[model samples]
Target: MKGLIVRIAAAVVLGAAIVTGSPGVGMAADATALIRAAFDNWRANSSESTVTMTIHRPGWERHLTMKGWTQGHDKALARFTAPAKDAGNATLKLGKTTLIFNPKLNQVIKLPASMLAQSWMGSDFSYNDLSKAEDILTEYSHKIIGTGHAGGHTVYSIEALPKPGAPVVWGKQQVKVRDDGVLLQETFFDQDMRVVRQMTTDKVGRIGGRDYPVVVTMRPAAKKGQWTRLDTTAARFNVPIPAYVFTRSNLQNPRN
Candidate 1:
């Protein structure tokens, strides 16, 4: 009778463990799904927008205006349209390769991997940052680490760790997204888990029938009194983009 009672107790303990473990697994899966869904929400089939970027430094400030187009995460083009010095400057990304067009030099230079971390057009955003829209979902494993309230909406705080062998620079990334799929903040860390930089939504509003962050800011961790602010002036989603827009020829000679 004693042996039988011990066996029954063991079975009960095992059953309890299984019941408790399943929810934790399910929660993780749900968090990942939410992240992927948020990416899809932000990245439509095609998009076009006009923006103004302000680079703030301790001693100087400058503003740039540009138009941008993107078709999927792999293809994007941006052309500077304001400030005569930067006018006609453009950058194009096709797959893994990136090219920049300089009106002064009349040259289209392909950016190598070594230049990925450099600031784009002296803005706080790097060439790598512009191209990593899809990597947050594909190259990292995500888990919901905590929760908070922002602008009266519940936000999920997610931690993303790069998968083994993934071609990424950050050791980890922390993101906060609202329940309705709006990205509120994203923080990047170095390999040693030191905070490198962060981007945050400064203003949220309706754009192209979707709730989006119309104004965002990027600030490096060590660079006090310096930041770059991007404000969307206009936007259209799921619109038709001309094929030539993504080609090398169009980098300098853009056609309407």
Candidate 2:
């Protein structure tokens, strides 16, 4: 229940930004701006989306259907809508706080700072990915180190190093983006500089009249035959989202 599709929406919006941003070889992009462009594109004023998440384990797989809403960068709510057992479960993020709503328990629980790095619902995505996926823009120093041409587009590889004392989990993050602002992939490294996990785009296509990453997979380096795939089924960007949508009560109850 993170900004999964919203991020995908960013990729598509970037695909359309070729008119304003550079789109050829030898062009330079402001590292921070590049990061911001991808993040801000899809979540401009607000967004609503439907996504399917598939968790691939060594022996079995599980799928989930969820809906999400975002208003600006500070407020968001994602709730599971299908797979009967998981329905009505939700996660809400407001500024620095992240909370969970368990319909089974019928309680709203606030997540502690330490638990932000933990997995979300046994998935590969951490709570941080659900709540603070955009922190790289402000919490790290970024630089573009490589550039190449692919499929009539310029691709830039960026390195993001966490700023000192930042409450971030990764020691380093490498991001690859297309000139139009599409996020190609993101690789995470541990404090000892070892690869921990990575998220890669498997397919990019048009959805809801927008170019987007339709399939993205997250894999842990240490685990074999185990990964999570996120499919952005549908999306509507920059849509008017009601203010009440981000409230804790809405996360627990239903008002969307």
Top TM-score prediction, candidate number = 2
Error of 1 at 208 (Å): 1.0
lDDT of 2 at 170: 81
lDDT of 2 at 102: 94
Q: Per-residue lDDT for 105-220 in model 1, tens only?
A: 99999999878567777766776555344566778998899888777767888899999999987899887767666667778899999999877778788887787666767789
Q: Which whole-number lDDT from 0 to 100 does residue 128 have in model 1?
A: 55
In the range 1-256, model 2's lDDT, one tens digit per residue, is 3222224211111011111233332254877766665554445456677778788998899988877776676676778888999999888878888888999999999999888666676777765565335768788999998888877877788899999899877889887777776666788898998999887778776765555556777789999998877787887777778888889879888887
Model 2 scores worst on lDDT over the 10 consecutive residues at: 10-19
Q: Would you give me the overall lDDT of model 1?
A: 0.65
List of clashing residue pairs for candidate 2: 14-180
Residue 118's lDDT within candidate 2 is: 67
Q: CA lDDT of each candidate?
A: 0.65, 0.68
